[model samples]
Target: MKPMKTSYFPIIALSAVIVVIIMAGLLLSDAALVVDFASKKQAPSLSHPFGTDAYGRDVLLRTLSGLSKSLLLGIAASVVSGILALVMGIIAGTAPKWVDNAINFIIDAIMSIPHLVLLILISFCLGKGLFGVVMGIICTHWTSLARVIRGEVLQLKEQQYIKIAQKLGQSPWTIAKTHLLPHIFPQFIVGIVLLFPHAILHESAITFLGFGLPPESPTIGIMLAESMDYVLSKLWWLFLPGVCLVAVVIVFDRLGKQLKARFDYDNMRG
Candidate 1:
């Protein structure tokens, strides 16, 4: 089987830009570059790449701050969800029938709820904050990966390698450690990249709806929500950040899809 060629230069480029934006946001917070009322709602110029918000805050800085939080939250949610899913799926897949059934049922019930609503409920229940948002997004987003991991494990357990190990008197733990886990690690990593967009979108939506991040947290959704009031007048800066948020989300989604196709095709060929 030939390994499929995959180019991640675009992802790397986008990620670099994101990192630069984060650094700028962190640095500018200590010393404001036009964040007072005088710069509020000013149009884009050589000085301000993204214009200014209602408070005259540099729109670029605010957007970058929001982007930083969004990226961090997205990654946190993806990692938490992916790890939980992998652990749960492996246990259920390798264990007895009752455990598997229970896991499957719970996953199905959770997935049946609309994602936005689930995020909001979780966020609200946990109390609004960055940590709450991360937990909320992770709680709701792992069902799909759980299912995928469960299927993969079930299939893998029946494979010749696994059976050979079992026949050789290898303990279940050893078989799983030596064979199943390594084989699934790549799929798990790829699944995580794919999970980022969903986690990001849900995080934004929850924050926009006032259930995720705090009002002053500079999250992309909060920025958009704050911008909407003055969108018609005096506050173009508030809305501009939303556009940047959309662009970043789109970039992650596109990159994830590309990587998924590349990796999945390679897996199939192998």
Candidate 2:
């Protein structure tokens, strides 16, 4: 058997940087302080980088705070969805044919809808704000993850080692917990990372539509919304936060693709 490639150092480094940024945003309460009323809408400079929002709040600090909230919400929602996918996938893959069919049917039904539209409808119905956005994301984002887990479990369950485990009198739970979960964990990790960009985008979209984070919040969407009034006059500072949001989304997307490629290569070699 081919040895698994544990060379995910690049992903580790990138993930670490992201974690640090998130932690800094969370741990630093000073980020909420407004240093200058006169510097409102100021351009990037040594004194007031990222300018100031309409309320004279430090735009940089507010952006970081919003980022902290976005990341926290994304992680919580993604984890719950991932766990649901893992459990449902395992059951559908390992259980009798009828069970598999039922789960598969449900997953298909969910996927048939346009994901973003469904998220919007759910968020709207659940009432506007972060809580609604979280629920909307978790509800719609699990389908693809579930399918991936189901596919992996189906393949792993039929392998010789799994059969050997069963023949050696290993309990089903033990085999799943020890053998199956371990092998599939790398894919699971990648899946979680992959979900982040989507989560960020969805959260931003909900907010942009005035149904996400509160108006006073400095979310990327809120920043953009607030900037609309000054677009004709303060062009550079007005759109700066939206540019940063695009950058963040692109960074995660590139990272996820790279990690997925590395894992796919490892899987093929194995």
Candidate 3:
């Protein structure tokens, strides 16, 4: 079935372009992170759009940089987790009974743990840098997506073509590579799209809790975490970064839903 054209194209394009805009903003705002003692703790004035942080850097520039870092982290975690899900799912769905049981057991074990606790432990265990945070998200986030993909492949396994291919002496690997994969591509895409908001939110949460990237990092999580220090004294610093984080997450949430709708199998067939 062909993908049906939908009204979501603009929003989807906007979502994609957002990453580019963030990247460009980060590149262009290198000088903006510089601190000035004279303008410390200014409110949201015209000269300093998002006001000034304690060190007197423009909050707007820092916010944009932080958002870009969050976006980057979200994309990294989602894509890596998605790929792990795809592989594990295919293996579980197509492999033998014991193999399926083993994979299922692991998935069950991972999902049984509290998500944030697991993320924090993993991040802390790995020393809580960029690599550690990414690894933690990647490790924890794949289980649900893997289950979805496994169910999809299991259903596809029952289809006539799959049975016919098996009977005709096609190897399992060949059938999986040529037939099963294409059939599940839509679900894979939807799963990854839906993973973004969760990834971003978790990244921020873990970071805000001081178990993610370093305090010196200019990420949304770190920004929010630092905001607690002066939140009572200077609300603008907290308000601006916090609001931008919410806005970014909301945009990604809407974008994910829109993409899922656009890629829905029924919608594509229509």
Candidate 4:
């Protein structure tokens, strides 16, 4: 009998759904803001599947808009954080002992603080807007990935091939570019993917606490925050945005793990 084939249908389907949500949300976000006093405080029905808010704004549209914004924010923050990590890690691994120690100290200092507290403080100090939220996430999210990359680079540097290249007059930059960077590329990719959920969750938390985006902005955090008042009133649709946010976070987390597993399998084969 033939061996069973591995199925990627789940991954492909999830990815497609994510793309559709993002695109639809981006395009319809403005429409989600439209308020209709006549339809205010609606329950889920044929006219509005997710119902309407106090301002008669469609809950589904608002949720979609918020999710898309959060997802985009996560992508931006994660990529920037990952790049920062890559640079810092490379420097820590290759530079003098003092420099390495300094980087490690900085990483330890940042990690020691509570993530939510640091994020709130940074966002508050930055004046609490889109810029503040993005900067806050970027600043706080790079330490872990930096440590990983630093360890990988340090290990590669001790390899005999790297020593041979160094003895043959190869420049440090050249060696890093050709060898270290390539070797660590997989880890870098995986780290950035993993950072997505953290960035999204942190962004939501800060915003929900009234320290990230402005209240007027249609973000998942803001939606969740506003839904608090209606919770006691039993307005279930109002909290649907929070549910969607959690779903997106879970999806991204799973995606990252899948990518890591695939990379590990490929590495083992290689």
Candidate 5:
């Protein structure tokens, strides 16, 4: 097939994302309320695309709802983590000597711990609910992005124009606002977009391990975990949510890579 026009790429990407979100949303309302023991464990068919789970709930609807839930949580976690990364990066890159050292030390301290263990500890401490998962993800996910931005800003700070601005008595804040931020914004956007998949995967992992959301929650992790029982029983529905989760993750990962390329310094200059 012929390639699409460059101008249409974002439109296509945005439409795919919207279609996924909209379908997930539309299926959410019906998924949570329907349960018929008579249809329990049905195979995939025309009337039930994903069939029914062992509980007789429509697997397709549940998968869609779980996907929507996970995506929303991932978005929230990524945004919070991204903002934390921005603040930490800015401080470490541009702050006074002592402040920079302090922030760097804190980052190192956190990085010393195993990430999943840290997430579990934090989530467990926060009581393992929606808030716990969000907070845990936000706290743990910022270090790498912060480090990237810190390096970018450190390089920017040494530029001849930055020195000129300092010599001309421009305040640090003023120089940062006018020069540093614009240079790093692209990097920042790329980091945030990339963070989404990690957030989603980590959220699911922690929830599956029982350190995030509760069993009562309608999340992708719960569906996958619960579906494990039927996997060996020749039940096609067991893998339905797992497949959907993989597809969603792949889509977001592709979107993130595309965003990164679009904002890439070399690509933009070209």
Candidate 6:
């Protein structure tokens, strides 16, 4: 018999850390809002591992709160984007030539724009809040995944089983439901997982640029934006939130890679 795989350990550990961060953020969210003028601008100490911001709020708690919000936003945006990609991909894969051409042209148009610029414009047009940021991410981030899914579907259309399904006189919708979706499910999962980091980073960047969440919001982007003024003042702790954001992004990136590898291995074995 083969020895037990040890590769799952990293995945488990990384997932646990992310869960804890999200949970801690939810729990500390209310507490993070409590400001103490007397404690403002304090450096890192035992009581405040990340120190106090100029507003006298606990940096660590606030960071956690922001991270949680970001994670949730990322989840929401990525899932929506993934679903959108799935729909467009199916249409492109099964539709008439003119329809597929239209879809490809639209995808190309969206992809040609600088991602961040498109995100900013969408968010701004949507009125620059939670809804705006989420819509922006969903619209901008779906293009790449949609293209991937479209390619997968196109390839699947050539497979013997799919050809047989077509010969069976199955409708495009039926074939998509019965054949395409199951085959592409793994890719969808992987795409969504990989999209999380991009969603989170874009949200933060949009917020930082004042096109996303409001300044009063407890988000990493807001935290970093607020820290900018104090950067020259040697308030090193102010940057802690930015560091945490980077760590969280890295964790998500690693988790996506691990999941992709696991899925690829499973596919190969199958």
Q: Per-residue CA lDDT of candidate 5, range 149-249, in tens?
A: 99999998899999999999999889988999888987887788788888988898899888888887667788888877776898866687878778877
Error of 1 at 120 (Å): 1.1
Clash pairs for candidate 4: none
The candidate maximizing lDDT is 4
What C-alpha root-mean-square deviation, in Å, does candidate 3 show against the real structure? 2.6
Residue-by-residue lDDT tens digits, candidate 4, 1-270: 433333467678976887888999899989999999999999999999999999999999998888888888998999999999999999999999999999999999999999999999998998989999999999999999999999999999999999999999999899989989989998998899889999999999999999999999899899889889888998988998888788877887887777777777777667
TM-score attained by model 6: 0.94
Instruction: Name the lDDT value of residue 148 in candidate 5.
Output: 95
**How well is each residue in 81-143 modelled by candidate 3, as lDDT tens digits?**
999999999999999989999999999999999999999999999998888889999999999
Q: Report how far off residue 201 is in candidate 3 (Å).
A: 1.5
Give residue 209's error in model 2 in angstroms.
Answer: 0.7
**Candidate 4: residue 67 Cα off by (Å):** 1.0
User: How much is 63 displaced in model 2, in angstroms?
Assistant: 1.3
Clashing pairs in 6: none
Residue 49 error for model 3, in Å?
1.1
Model 5's TM-score against the true structure: 0.90
lDDT of 6 by residue, 171-225 (tens): 8889999989998998898899889999999999999999999888899999999
Error of 4 at 31 (Å): 1.2
Worst 10 residues of 2 by lDDT: 27-36
Clashes of 3: 0
Q: What is the Cα root-mean-square deviation between model 4 and the actual structure? A: 2.5
- Candidate 6 wrongly placed segments (more than 4 Å): 1-6
C-alpha lDDT of residue 254 in model 2: 83
Clashing residue pairs, backbone N/CA/C < 3 A, model 1: 40-56
Lowest summed lDDT window (length 10), candidate 3: 261-270
Number of the candidate with higher TM-score, 3 or 4: 4
* Residue-level lDDT tens digits of model 2 in 1-270: 553455667778876877986887776536555556676667777766777766677777777776777777878888878887888888888888999999999999889999878898888899868778999998888888888898999899889999999999998789889999988887787788878878888898888878888886667788788788877785477677677778878888887777777777777977
